[model samples]
Target: MIYLDNAATSLKKPQGVIDAVVSAIQHSGNAGRGSSETALQASRTIFQARQALNQLINGHDPRQIVFTHNATESLNTVIKGIFNKGDHVISTVMEHNSVLRPLYELEEKGVELTLLSINDTGTIDPEAVNNAIQANTKGMVITHASNVTGDINPIKKISHLLHQHQLLCIVDASQTIGSIPIDVRDLDVDILCFTGHKGLLGPQGTGGIYIRPGISIQPLKSGGTGIDTFSHHQPIDYPSRLEAGTLNSHGIAGLYAGVSYLLDFGVDKIRDYERELLNFFYQELITIPSIKIYGHFDSNVDRCAILSINIGNIDSAIIVEELIDRAEIITRGGGHCAPLMHEALGTREQGVVRFSLSHYTSKEDLLTAVKCLKDIPKDLN
Candidate 1:
């Protein structure tokens, strides 16, 4: 099957990633739980994974990389950890549910939320963010890229703006981390959350967050941190303060390998190739008379290798299912777990079929998929 649903989770992982996980399960034990060889191996694996992630994002300290089950958990840790009652926070309508649900819950607990509107093309004005700042405004939490529109935000510019005002800058980098050349220090992002399963090319259940220096947040949970058992409160340290139980050592082993592969191949090469493939597919899509594509299709723009479209008024889920059944094309449909973005596009009801391309996607496969979608208008009738 032609796998185009990579935005959800990259179904195609490198052989190194698979091999690392298998090795970890075979030889590694609970990290930091014992003095045995297996336990030591597990501990080393987690440490190395943290190091890889640190280099991947050019973070300040490897110690600040807090691993979690997924981006949702990582985002939750940051959202619940930092904000408090009556704190005014700025966000955007292009956020995925991972950021939305947590912010909504915080709103119930008294955090004020101001969602900034984006243009029809999914681009937000950096000036609007500056205009929204108030006395009580604690900071801004923004997505590095729109999962629906594949639009890259000017985070470096926005981060500079927020820092000028001494406000916090939290970035949800779930869709951009591995695909985009993101350096925590260069971007000046105070808190950045990401998932390893997507662009990282790692296994599922692996994600993390980065918190910059001179910043503190409440722990989302408290438990044994493999050190200082005598302390009553969570350890006042970088990762130990946020990490509550045994880490996902095996998954981290895979993540370590996955990120290393990315480094070896180079993120720039991967990004450019994927963008070329997206342009190739889009060239075919734009010619379809009945197709209405969402978001701007600019090859020069640095966006994710993703495209969303609809043929006539057909239900997107139906199109997605048909592609899987008849065309053997794997894709994502519906609101894409991004209701606010769907509402913004006026596709909340009809939804839109999404094609999240990957580095592994082939030209032949893309042509076949485009041909199938081109015939969709005929099939609908």
Candidate 2:
């Protein structure tokens, strides 16, 4: 099968990732719970994974990278924990459900939310951020890139602007973390959330959040931390503050292998190649009059290697099912969890068929997808 649904999660992981997960499950024990050999093994593996994440994002320290189950958890930990009642936060319509849902929950709890609007192509102007600021606006949350349209946000610029207003900045980098180069220190972002399973090319059940120094987020969930068992309150530390209970050591070990591979291979090289595939597919898609592709298509633009399209006015689900059955191609269809984005694109009902590419998605794979799309009309008859 030709897998193109990488935005959901990367299916093809490196060999080291597979081996590391297996080794972790077989040999490692609970981290920070004991001093036995197996426990120490788990501790070391998790530490190494944090170190890899620190290097990948150019974080201030390894301990600043707090491991969570996925980006959703990381986002919630920041969104729900950082703000107070009546405080306002800013987000965009192009955000995933992870960002929107928590913000909605926060709104229900009396925190005011200011969701910015995106253009028809899913790009939000950075100026809209400056305009949304108010005295009650204590923080801003923006996705590094749109999962639906692959539009890359100017995170550094937005962070700088928010900082000038003394607003805390949280960037959800679920789509841009590994495939795109991100330096937490350089961006001066307060918190950056990521998932290991997507662009990071790791196993599932792995993700993290990077918080810069001097910024503190309250613990979302509190439990045993091995050191502060007696204390009723969660520990006020870098990692232990956010991390409670035993981590997913096996998945983290695999994430370490995945990130290490990206570091050695270089993120820029992977990005360049993926862009080549995106452009190849986009070029072919635009040529077909019946196909409607989303987002602003610019060959020189710095966007994620993803595309959203619809075959004529046909239902996206039906077209995706045809591709799966007849062409052995896998693509994501429907709203994709970003309801506001679908509304902005006037595709709330039709949804979209998303094709996300990674370093391994080749020219030949895109060619096959193009041919399938081109012949879909003939089959429909």
Candidate 3:
């Protein structure tokens, strides 16, 4: 199948990723729990993953990054741990359920929440965010890019404004981490959540959070963290404090390889290639009057390679099925876990047929998708 679901989880991983994961499972033992040769190898793999992550994001220290099951978990850990009752927070309507749900739960507990509205183009105004801050506002959480609309947010501007207010900034970079360039130091983000499988091209169950120094968070799950075994209390370190369970050595090994591949190719190169594909798709799809495309159509937006659209009179599910069954093309449909974004875009009822591209997607694949979309009957009754 010609997979177009990179935003969900990249299907075509770098060759090194698969090899590294398999090699780790075959040769290495449990990491950080023992001193055996196999265990040492596993520990090295985990270390390399952290190192790769640091290099990818320009993080301060590798140890400050904590591996989690996925971006959702990382977001929840930060949202629930950092904000207490009576604290106020700011988020955008473009946020996925991952960020929205935690903040919603906090709202019930008297944590004031302000969901800033976005324009129809899915762009959040940084000035509006600055206006929303109050005396009790402790943090501002925002997604780097809309999972549904692929609209890139002005994170740097938001960061600057939030810093001026002495409020923490938490960014969910699930859609933008590997696809776009990000420097944690440059962004001044307190907590950054990212998924490995989406942009990083790693296996599923691999993701992480980068916690800036001076930000303390309670652990989501307290358990054996290899360190502080003698003491009953969890270690009060950057990663160890938040990471309270055995690491996902195999997935992390794959993530390291994927990141290494990106490093060698350069993130700019990947982004440029993907932008070419997105621009081509956008230009071509707009010619069809029956199709309604979402997101910032301008290529200058520096957006992700995700496109959300719908053909007139065709249900999104049926379009997805046709793409898969008739064209041998795979794409995603429905809200994409960003119901707020879909609602904002007026696509909640039918959702949107999403064709998310990757660096691996070729001109031929785009042509094939375009041909299929053009051929589909506009009247689906």
Candidate 4:
């Protein structure tokens, strides 16, 4: 089947990632609990993963990185750990439910929040975010890229502004990591959340957070960290402060391989390739009178491999079913866990079909998708 749902989870993981995961599971034991040869190997594997992630993001210290189950959990750790009652926060309407739900729950607990509106192109104005800040504004949370529209927000500028205002900057980079060129130090983001399965091309259940130095947040979970066994309180250090319980060594080994592969391939090369495919798909699909595309048509303003569209007189679910059953193509059709984006884009009533490409996606796949979509029976029963 022709898989096009890379934004949800990439199907074409690098061979190195698969091999690394399998090898780690076969050879390594519990990472930090013992001193045996197998345990030492596992510990080294985890350290290597941290180093790979640090290099990928141009981070200063590898110890600042903390692994989690997924981006949702990482985001929760940041949202719940940092802010307190009466604290004001600023976010955009393009946020996924991972960000939106936590903010909504915080709002109910008397934490003030301001959600900046986005234009029809799904781009948020940094100036609007600056204007939304109040005296109590403790943090500014922004999504590096919209999952539904694939619009890249102006993060560096926002980060600069937040720094000037002395407010913490939290970025949700789940959709941009590995596909976009991001330097944690250059971006000046205080907290960056990421997932390994999407653009990183790693196995699921691998994700992490990068907390800038000098910033402290309470841990969401507290237990034995294999360090500071005698202390009742959780260790107040970089990773040990955040990480609790046994880590996902197998998934992290795969993630390390995936990140190394991306570094060798160069992020710019992957991005350019995906852009070519997106442009080809957009230009060809626009000619079909029955097809309606979402997001900005201009590749410069809003750029990513993800595209959302709908066929006239057809339900999105029906289109997805037809694409899979008849055309042997795989695509996702639903709100994509970004209900607020759907509400903003006017696709809440009927969720649009999503075709999210990756570096492995080719021109031939786009052509096949276009042909299959054009061949959908015009007459609706």
Model 4 ranges off by over 4 Å = 377-381
Is 1 or 3 the stronger prediction by lDDT? 1
Evaluation by TM-score, superior candidate among 2 and 4: 2
**What stretches of model 1 exceed 4 Å from their correct place?**
none
Tell me how far candidate 4 lies from the true structure as C-alpha RMSD in angstroms.
Answer: 1.3
The lDDT values for all models are 0.90, 0.90, 0.89, 0.89
Poorest stretch of ten by lDDT in candidate 3: 372-381
Clashes of 3: 0
Model 1: per-residue lDDT, tens digit, 213-245? Answer: 778989999998889999899998888998899
TM-score of each: 0.98, 0.98, 0.98, 0.97
For model 4, the local distance difference test gives: 0.89
Per-residue lDDT over 16-127 for candidate 2, one digit per residue giving the tens place of the 0 to 100 score: 9999999999999999988999999999989999998999989999999999999999999999889888898899998899999999988999999998998544676778
- Candidate 4 per-residue lDDT, tens place, 139-159, comes to 888899888878888888888
User: Per-candidate RMSD vs. true structure?
Assistant: 0.9, 1.0, 1.2, 1.3
* Model 2 misplaced regions, further than 4 Å: none
Error of 1 at 168 (Å): 0.7
Give the clashing pairs for model 2: none
- The stretch of ten residues in a row with the least summed lDDT in candidate 1 is 119-128
